[model samples]
Target: MRTSSGAGELLVELNRDSGVPLHQQLESGIRTRIRAGLLRAETVMPSTRALAQNLGLSRGVVVEAYQQLVAEGYLVSRAGGKTQVADIAVVEPTIAAPAASGPPRIDFRYSRPDVSEFPRAAWLRSVRRVLNETPYRSLAYIDGRGTIELRTALSDYLNRVRGTAARPENMLICNGFAQGSRLLLQVLAAQGRTRLAVEDPSDNDLRDVAQAAGLEVVGVPMLETGIDVAALEQSGADVVLVTAAHQFPTGAVASAETRAALVAWATARDGLVIEDDYDAEYRYDREPIGAMQGLAPDRVAYAGTASKTLAPGLRLGWLILPSWLVEPMAQAKLMDDRGSPVFDQLAFADFVARGEFDRHLRRMRPRYRILRDTLVDRLAARIPELEPVGVSAGLHVMTWLPPDLGEDALREAALQRGLGVYGLAPYWVAGDGPAGLVFGYGSLRRKEVVEGIDLLADAIATIRG
Candidate 1:
């Protein structure tokens, strides 16, 4: 039915014979009107009695619908006053015009998994099992260290897969690696540890995390082997963050010598190391390297996430802190939103325990390796001049551009040609570095990877001209 109010025109259609309840139908219709901006802010709604009488329904039905709308913040009700649409911001609908442009047809941005490969059936089954079997006590406010069940599962999993010596008591589940890093920084800041040293050409977002927590961020130049341990020691910074297994963007695995030197540096300086073991599972070449945390568990605080393995939306990550930092980090976690959602933690534990996680990885590793190989092969065939720097491991590979080509110009040209490519300039904290591009193949299919590289070669040619 359609009705004109003092504020504006409100149209609501009701199907009496439909299986949907009348109140819910009414609620949905009104909500749609509000969202569509047909009903503007402070628009007065029709009186429930009048609406019910006009629709030939009981006054109670209209009242219930209006109450629901009010509760959902779509409508506001004052004390014994008329109900009106809430002052909510609504996006204006786009007009039916010619399509201007869209995002790149193929994206090479890093750190995202192929979401199409997510094990939906297995995850759903795990969620169902967790819901069915969990005790009522598991539903309440639990430890900020996360459920012991998940921590224990993670400890065992890490020990087996990544060679990290973790115990349930020393592990803390976090929202994600981002949150885990922030919590560690918070605890460090509390202890008056003000300076944080990060890999020079590292992920900028992580550097910002330490800076946001009031720590002075220093950049240690990345060497061919790994982060420059000698430069790090010379910089006099006590706390260092390293992506040891597969360095981001550069993909430089720290050599055994560098690893030993880093451990010695930490031990001698009485310092701590934050190990970001991100995306260490999908190695295409040799077997994946064990985490640096295994070398010196007392000095390293290891962080890992399911962002690359399952999906970033899961927001599930864990931290394995040294004995000294465990209590402080736990207290920081407690103050930072209590803890990650308990249901997800429990469900993930069940997923790991049932071997679904490992099976999923085993299935995905080969697929990802194929995609990576396809990317490498196509890039070599099409753009032989660009040296692919980091192709051994991780989701992405770094391609060093010809000295004549500017990274910014090439990236812009590639984008114009419907090829999404990221430049390496943003990853540097020292303000300058080698010009290159980071190409991630995790989310791209084989054909898409080939087509994207072809387009990229064309873009590079266009830029050179």
Candidate 2:
């Protein structure tokens, strides 16, 4: 059999005194040799037992190292057949990054729901009703598509509030938008579409999710109006993901022309659109922008989450997809995690049916509106040099800084003054963007917003002077 393991010459050079773990060292050696073109495609590798004996190591250690490389696709094993180096063209799957090491010092990061505003009393009332009324058998492994009550409620809610044309049969309830996106990406990848074009200056977590499914993410430029369709046309992406309403961080509403252009492009290319209508409920500027899915229900996959309006802890998100994608996405959901909590889904359905959700949104909208107004006023009063972007809607604003005040220096200075802020640098694929900080006013008290800006002003002035 042809050999790929490079065990003949390289194993002799491994020193027992090396600080690295033996499994890791062995794993690295095999991968390096593959990349060096020393291991030809389909070259057979000895069994771990045989290689261990040849190298004077424990069989289990060699097995562990081989398994690691196999998991990463450096090696491939056919059932009841010899192991071999993976072809250069093979794609490897990746898992999500481990949770961030520790709690951020003071997180002013955007994308967080206002945890302070969760309607606990109403939710408890709804949960109590669901638990008491639900039949005992309803608790068994659910339909995987979601509870019937939720699917019905979601069907109505998306149409009434967000302008989506999806039916109960087309909706799938997952843990949240992250899980929904992952399942969709998995389906897309399974269909042989490897690259997804997503908006740059958007959420990194989405990019992480797509990449975790063994798909390449190409960054598409987003203009003040929306994603640059001209650039998107050039990208040759099979799927285009967009946040049309209230683009995150930069917060540009996709213009009507841009929105129409995207639909036409997708129609021409026979591609699909993933619409993340994130934070569509809290539009202070005008009537909410109707969902893009409404215009082309068969082509657009609409995703909405309660995380922005209610609470992230709820972990409730829904996807309204074209008819073709529904079952595949549902199966992927079952494989990922067997749907979200049934109790929460039932309670949320009750919340929506009772008009309590509308009441909650109505109450929170004005409260957040006041907070946003205060944030803008305070920043103007205290930090005259800083400019706020995308203040018309959503829960947060990006404060652009003058060139003399570098984002990193300003961020460190603010931390010293007991204020938390984030730089926009991490959000971009291309480096050194409009230097700014994202300020979230959702749960922040008026006094806190005022004081935070005061501290930020002092920090900026100190950095500049």
Candidate 3:
């Protein structure tokens, strides 16, 4: 019999002496292969004549086998005289039973915005406008920093909204905040700056980024106001990363006094400040705070991203660097990815220029504010002991748990009741802090937010009892 080993070939052995009919044996073999997932859906089967010739059988036997499998729904006959496996539903193998079951139904993870509210219509219009207006030359490999049009638009926007000292020549568009941070760290390492200081209780992923670049990461203590500028100065690091507007997880705004102290510290030590202006657009109580880069533009490298305002999947972020670091940062970006995609940058520029971006933010801020208020109100009314702190700004609020309860235990209990609550233990890099939970209200609706907090309170009560 003609036999060949290939990805699509099926191996079959038929015995004329056996009591089983040739057609029945072929069908059984094909059925077993399908059930075992060896033959996947839509995989083409060898033609009847070819299979019969290869197996030294009559064409009628092969045809009968094929017709039987077709009737059983394991195979399908397609147009243009082709036979292929049908889209049959197969039972997957259950590897093992889980000890604790699946994840919670309601998630309260931090730093995520309401993606369902993304402005699809406005974005599509902007994309079409950019594609129509863009020159052919702009599509080729050009500036490593980004399209000049996008940089100019960002310059105007940052200056007007955040009070930043931005210039098109000094801005570089990056993949996201993570990539931008990596590029900055690489540039600093090149300059023989080996130490990087970050705010304690900050995002662990950011500290890992610095460590990945072979730089020593030191944690500076966070105060009630913001990062303790006094401790940061003593850290003796050449570069420090700060979230001045709304600190992650804590939602603490850096005070004017603290901002001035940080700027002066950078000036005195000739150190560099990397300002991550993440989520500064979603302030509820008062006017949003301006960027710290306005105070000392030459020393601070201001970074912003569309992850909070739009979506994280876009991977769009920018850095407004000091005049001296422009070439170095751009060079690092060149070696990293040869700059971010140009089309998205152009589309974002069009979106900002047409005022669609600001309009979207205006529409979203009130909804987020109401959600924030609802979360705080529901938690306070349901569980008086679980006090919600940092309620004025950002997408999340930190609540201090009771001194008697452990944060991890409470989180696990909440998860069991289909409620996801995050503990603050992972945020701290050093010494222990009070037990707390972080609730992100951005993705949860008003009713869901209320119900979630009630369930969380019930979980805590059961744990205490």
Candidate 4:
């Protein structure tokens, strides 16, 4: 253990033999103490004269260090010439950065759409049109349920595209699917719903959202097709959240029989089904599955977002709720940030109504499809032992790792090579799922996809020995 001299009342550590400057050492030592809360706010600090004399240092060195810290706002100098630790909030970090790797050069982690391909031109046009045509009073605190105009437009669009049964009166505009789910879950919890069932191996923040709304999160097993209805029934959950169209991470489209069973389950138990129609538009193999909300509108609350098709930065999403839950959901939303920004809602309303949203999706589907195909082909060529599961739809493919290859070892080795990829184990609700890696190619071009696979092979070779 290293020893430090106690200067005055404050014990600022310093090393004379170290190459670092005395003033710099003094500043850092004090700064660390302040941030660590040992030197708390309003605690008087020793004068530079006393500190320098006590540490056997020249007064000028202590003066320089204290002035620099004051300039940096870590210490406050008062009118009476008293220097004290400044009032600042600093969160202590819990995780350390990896020492063996540089920043990821080829990021393949999932959940984001290709931001480079976002329809900027059409979105700008829509915003300008809304600003010009819409009544100025519409910008005022209108309704907690969002502007009726946006809800109406989303209703028409989702109904036509996703086979959703939505109405403007029952729909609510949210900041994103996150806030929407939170609001709805709050409403559910208020109505005495205690438990929420989510599919195992889910990769999104839905479970966290449910828990925040005071509902116990239960994980039902996911089948090859979709969530296992039998397990969901046995999970003792009154509410369920599902990605009905295309399951995230694993691209499993729920079968017709499974869909029928889910509807039946909801009706029989008087349970609520929250349908997250995530990535419903980008189906490369066959027609995209329709929303399950059309079949059981009353039993299911359907949610859709502009996040995947447009951009996540927009923080725009909509929810189509049942008639009975609409009012309570609106009240919940009112309490939670007073119903998302009106300008964004109105602009998105105009975007959906103008057919530009449809145009954007049509263009992006092929681009993402090409990337998906490249990743699959490259993986097959480089790592044929790895089996690609659920590749028929969505922006990413979840590949099951071979029994011999551990996910954690491969992931770290891949990271050291500057290739970012996520293992499937963390997504498992109960830590009992097959080892896999989620390869998201939505943001990557075709050439990068090829190189990423090459890097993956090199990383695999490192851990294989």
lDDT of each: 0.88, 0.83, 0.87, 0.85
Clashes of 4: 0
Per-residue lDDT of 441 in model 2: 73
* RMSD (Å) per prediction: 8.9, 15.1, 6.0, 10.6
The parts of candidate 1 lying over 4 Å away from their true place are 1-100
Best-matching candidate per lDDT: 1
- In order of appearance, the predictions have TM-scores of 0.82, 0.76, 0.83, 0.78
What clash pairs does model 3 have?
none
- Model 2 earns a TM-score of 0.76
User: How does residue 368 of candidate 1 score in lDDT?
Assistant: 87
What is the per-residue lDDT of model 2 for residues 170-225, given as tens digits with 9 covering 90 to 100?
Answer: 89998888888888998998898878998878777778788888888888888999
Query: For model 3, how many clashes?
Result: 0
Candidate 4 residue-wise lDDT, 1-465, digit = tens: 212223465677889999999999999998888787667677778888889888788999999999999999998888877777777723344578677656689989787788988778888988898888988788778687899989899999989989999999999888888889888988899899999998887864777778888999988877877899999988888999898778876777789999999999988888999999868888889876789999989999998888888889999988999999989988888887887887788888888898888888888888888888888899889988777877888888988888878888887888887889889888888778889899888888889899989999988887776
Candidate 3 lDDT, 1-465, residue by residue in tens: 222234335687677789999999999888888788767777778988888878888999989999999998998899988888887723344578886777677888887899999999999998998889899999998687998988999999999999999999999999989999998898888888889988877878878778888899988888888999989878888898899898877878899999998899989999999999989988888887899998999999999999999999999999999998999888888888887898899999999988888999999999999999998888879987777777887899998777788987888888888888898888887648667888987888898898898998888789879
Query: What ordering of candidates by TM-score runs from best to worst?
Result: 3, 1, 4, 2
Ranking by lDDT: 1, 3, 4, 2
